[model samples]
Target chain A: MVFENKNSHWIDPYTHKFKESFKDINLLDKKKEYWRFASPSIWYDKFTLKKFQETRSSQSIKFDVTNYNFLRFNDGILDTETLRNFINKNKNVEICSFESIFLKKDHWSSLKFCQAQLNAEKSYERPLALFNGFNAKDGVFIKFKKGVKKDLHIIYEGNNKKNCCIRNLFDFEENSEIKVYEHFYGNSKYNVVSELFVADNSKFEHYKIINQDISETVIYHFFGNCKKNSKVKTVNFSFTDTPVRNEINLYLEGTNCDATVASMGFGKKESSICDNTVFISHQEESCKSRQIIKNALKSGAKAIFQGKIFVASKAQKTDGYQMSNGLILTDDCEFLVKPELEIYADDVVCSHGSISGTLNDDHLFYLRSRGIPLKEAQKKLIQAFFSEILDEVSDDNIVYYIQNQISEILTL
Target chain B: MFEIKDLHVNISEVEKKIINGINLKINPGEVHAIMGPNGSGKSTLSYTLSGKEGYEIEKGDIELDGESILDDEPDERAAKGIFLAFQYPIEIPGVGNLSFIRTALNSQRKFNGKDELNPAEFLKILREKADYLNVDMEMLKRPLNVGFSGGEKKRNEILQMALLEPRFCILDETDSGLDVDAMKQVSKGVNSLRSEDRSFLIITHYQRLLDYIKPDFVHIMAKGKIIKTGGPELALEVEDQGYTHLLN
Candidate 1:
């Protein structure tokens, strides 16, 4: 059931109908391979559906994005007034509600694509996406015209015990480029699903930072599709003590396309679980995909990384690489890494690697011998371990922000 | 400046004594070289003195400037003006060489109640020392000793020693993996840091390094004990007659 008491104005009748109609689907089965490592049902069983009214604090938050467009989401609900202002200010960009696409016959294909993604068997394999499909109050749909270049900053903030779902769709036309910064903060259950479609010769840089309260549960799923010669880079930076599961799937459907998925996480508290799962599919010739994930777990925290690369039989000359490294900081903590490569193309160059261990004693001795304190040395090494992956992000401002956040995570 | 009396150390994993009843002392401005054969516990002595874990000190007292330092942590010992240059310098990826040295230097300064240097001030001193050692400033931008050659790593160790400026230095086979040219370069860097207020304990198996930086005293160690001690001529004696001949 969805939030029924609070004034969820954006919650349409279709969402309610979808929940009731799809009650028989067993998407959260514990036996499913996708959910095998992290059994969501354990937490799902303890949760009860209810309407939680979020109090608007007197302290308003402001982001320094004077040169960029900003969108705000309050507990899975969009601010229509601000959205209208954004659309009015930007004449070349098209931003609307998800339902608006269904009203126009000329955009029928876009709507069909959304429907197929929402109902596809593979998408349903992830229970959180299905949960979002039947509960999202409203979704934002953004499209860029040919040769359009812009920076969009999206903020998600909320609190209390509300169970909320959020959906976002981004469509980039040919030759267009966009850089997006999505920041999430709060203590609440969230089911967030985002779909990105990159057309030929288009480029997109998507940065997602998750810094939620330790008592919250977050499940985020991202699907990206790249066309001919298009490049897409998605980086996820997460530091949470609660249960946070991130699933990223990228499809290289067009020739000469390249997709890079890089993520870094730190689990810092007892029983804090952070799981990152990524799947990349190369379906065309000469397509390239790279995945690098790093995690540092301390205390009794646990971290898991599952990465899979799939090269189709016809996708010759595909270059796929995957690596996952985990730094276990304490004896009480646990880190598990699983890297898989499924290649059907004979000429493809595919490789995968996974390594997990504690800090090197010799390295530690070297640092301490030079007079660095134990704690300071550990922090430096841990930060350096993540520097390689952080360097992949081209934007210096975003990288700086991430570095500061990482420092905070360690201190906390 | 540095003294070890009746030092007895044993490995924790096994019941065998690695450092069996050794006594040594070094005054200020003196460079003492210890020549020992393989399996003579030379490394064990260095590790025990540097406060590495797992080596049980059965009976010993290590003193720096008349203060016992056997119970101090590695960082504490470093703060008290003791430095060890590892035989095999470790590679720490992702940590820039300049940053590591600055951190180490500032950490000591902080412990000694001195103000830390700003980036500009630190860089100025680093450039001076690095240039004096003929070390490329570009190499400082890379990770600490990562991808460095054998000689480069040894030079980095000396660079750190020069920056930290410890009162007492322990060199653990710093010349084992270097050619003649590289050895001379490393020795030159070490000699540049020599002063009346500093003392050094150079541990090596060969006498070649002595040609560049002459030692005031030389000792022969065998079976975890200081079997013989003499002036610089002892190093020549060992060089002319192998360790086996001297032991016999």
Candidate 2:
């Protein structure tokens, strides 16, 4: 049964659209190219659309929000007191709930942007994202004024909920800059979608850290639109024990736009699966796009990466690069990669590569001969394998936190 | 005191014997040079001593200070004061050179139940030693042996030898790819570390390296065994007469 948001007059129309789309969408079709390696039945069979009762108190969730503008959510429910405090402190930026923004006459442009994003032509490709939109009764909407700079920390804590879905929208005006850190915690299955609009000459950096229990499953969709001379960069660090699929789609709509996406994941358990699907479309001239995805899988674990760069005929002088690598620790692990480049422009430079292999024996011997034990040496090499993607992250605090999480995952 | 007693070894993968009935000994403060023609198993002996995998010991024992070390791992042997400077240093693309050396030093220290040095202390020691070997700060900051010139890699190896301060050092054709200046610098670094309690095993094909770091005993090796043992004059004999006379 689809979730019905009868209370919100503005969101009911999208919920109805979701129900209509669900009739034709088949998530478990093995014939579908995108769904071939990852069968949705693994999670779809156990997913419950009915809202879960909040079984755990908010006091159980713990976080450190020092040196960050903070927001917290528990089982898809926001902490209004923290939101109020955040709003009182930051007066220049507009932060409000989706329903309130839709009702406000002065914020009609923001509402229109949200409606257009919901009705995007490519929305049908991702059925789970539409499901999230239908069930997400209330979500945060943030808009930055021109030339503003800030760092925001958003945390989601799940307490054994059967299913939790949330949506978020970010708007960066011209010449503005912002860095967002999204963290997911606890044992609830999650369906999340975030849309970003980057205006001319703006910079937006998004970092996501997913560390959750082995029994949970997470499906995330990220969409971005970049205008002239805009920059959009995102780094994802996933250290989860269960299945996780992160889908990212970025469109370069204006000239001189730059978009970069990088992800690092480690799958340790036999049931672990980490999937990343990314598409970058260059519709304008002189744009650049880069994607780097790396994963280290242990015995019986699996990793999948399907990335593509699409350049339109008029998008001349486009430079696109993509590289995907997997380090298989044992013979039983699997790494499936399909890196594609679709170029219609004659004057474009695009390249893609995929490689999967075990650790080099000579490198291992060198370290062991130097007095580093075998296990420590292997750990160091594994850390080094992910160092390239980690180097792309700009914040030191986040890097340290991610490194700690990676170490913990490795030990497990 | 390091001793190799009638050692016999083979390449484990192909089961081809490389070291056949070799015996050698080096007391405190003695520098031994093993010179031989190609395929003489000098490198095999060095690798066998360093506990590298794939070199199976079929017979004989390798003892350090009167204790057999056949069962120890490479790292365990390293903690017992054994160091081998490779002819071709492996390139690790992401591990920093300085950090690699520091980790090695600390690993040995931990194995020996000693306290490890902090970064500041390790850096101070490394800087002092690296300067002597002509290894600059930039080379140490880069990935270990990645994109380094032959001389720079050899110098980096010597710097590690200097930092680790092993009691029994094995130079496995360390001067093969080095120029005259680099050879001199490496020789000087090795000579500086020689003392009453330390020993050296220098494996080389040319006598030019021996001219820089003089050896106390020179052994001519051929066909997986040492054919003859003499003083430094034996190296000059091989350089002038070649190994045909020694083999016959």
Candidate 3:
């Protein structure tokens, strides 16, 4: 749904509706129904009907839930009597997290939907939309209870000899905040797409870091709604040979809403490129949105950044800013940055900017004459060029850790 | 301590000799100035002695203290106490001046099997030398000549020579672009570094610097060759009549 944000400083009007209506919103976000990052349902089924079926190749795994007619946890955690009560109390929720290690193909194929629970509502997200005509192939389902905040750390490792296609879905109840970290790394190469939904007053912060070796990945993401004062933040860092295209749309359906997306990409060698496209819509007045992407290109690599902001006619007083920059290290490298703004509201404050260029040549010459070799001289100049943004990263330990990783990455 | 016999430097694939040197000698406790007009190869002669590669040494045997150094690399020559205070001092950004000089000094020390000075010890000795030449303390904090002005850049060259304490420091036209005040300071720094065990090849086109760092002998260079040699009076003659008299 397009954001009807006006007067972006005001709290989201949708946040109030969810708290007031209080109906479990499984579709706060529309695109998420199409490109969910994961579907939790497959995980739930593993412990239920698929207990005998191993999700993976080896079955030396200790935890097998297939022997039980119903599977569940005790008191929201793994307690012995609580698990016994859950198994005896008519297993309602299917859980599949760490249990994936026991099964081949994942915790998914193990569980099958039993007709006995015909009255059961559908899970929150379904990632495998086209698998065997059973869209539940990859998905996550959460029966959100009011005021229950759950934290999840998810890592998507593309550990396949061949390419892989994955879809993910997630859900939240009213007044709940779900934070998910999606880290993507491949033993070789793969592509991943995800969809996300946010209910009223529910906050979702999805942090993604993708490293696809020297290949590429295509990413599609959408943020559904913020009923009053709900916020969402998305951060991405990509340094792979793969050219990745990320499309993010922030729909502010409520007042006093805020959304922020920041990303950094590194392009090197003859790799084609990394391009990011951001679409931010202010559907309500007083809704604020901000997006910034920085790309550093080296060798003959290329990078592109395209962002667009849309302010609805009804959405007045909206504030939005989009900035992008590309730093080229070699003459052969290239970059293109375009910031797009379509504001139907006249009173809104909106801004867009982009900058790209090669490293300063005179600076390199100066260092070399001082007896510093050419390559070492460049490393110093590059460090200086990126220092400004490096300081902005601000996490002292993380910054130092990343700097060491960057040195290792660029040693070639 | 220095000798160049039939030294010729050819650049590019072509056999055009930049330094068609016949011969010259620099003894200990002596400061010899090679004065020449533009393109007379004064800088080339000093560079060849310092051993910057790519300028192919076609035929020549340069000896320092009776040891042939023409077969050595720039670092080897530097180890043998040959320093070239460049006409254009290079700026090494990010590398602080104090550290750069110490690295160069310690590299020579490593080759010589001498003890290397720690940062604390090196700074102490460096500050004293800098104080003797009237160079500001701020200079040592900056990147090597990165943003230095013309005069400051030239003075930095001598600062390096003083800290390294080379035995044969060749000032490659170090006085070319300095102001009158800067010229005096450059000469003062050079004069402080001159000693009995060390020698100096003061390459210049004018005699203005000789007034401060008096040379033991003056040689007039023309077309890559030393066409004339005499005492300090020879500098006065060139200063009075220019290179026209020497050319004739």
Between candidates 1 and 3, the DockQ winner = 1
Off by over 4 Å in 3: A1-412, B13-15
TM-score quality measure for candidate 3: 0.53
Question: Each model: TM-score of chain B?
Answer: 0.98, 0.98, 0.96
Q: Number of clashes in model 1?
A: 0
Candidate 2 TM-score over all chains jointly: 0.93
Query: Over the stretch A1-412, how does candidate 1's per-residue lDDT look in tens digits?
Result: 2345433334344456456645765646667766777786633533563321122112222335666688877776777776887898876688886545445546523542444244333533665665676666666788888999988888776655566677788888999999888877775567787888889999999888776342466788788778899998988887766677888888888999989888888877765777888888888999998898898888888887888888889999999989888888889987777788888899988888888888888888889988998988888889898998888888787777777777765665
Off by over 4 Å in 1: A1-22, A42-67, A81-85, A88-91, A99-112, A115-120, A212-215
Q: lDDT for every model?
A: 0.81, 0.83, 0.61
DockQ of every candidate = 0.82, 0.79, 0.10
**Highest DockQ scorer:** 1
| CA error at residue A7 for candidate 2, angstroms | 7.9
Report clash pairs, candidate 1.
none
Order by TM-score, highest first: 2, 1, 3
Model no. 1, DockQ: 0.82
Better of 1 and 3 by TM-score: 1
Predicted chain B of candidate 1, TM-score versus the true chain B: 0.98
- Model 3's alpha-carbon lDDT is 0.61
TM-score of chain B of 3: 0.96
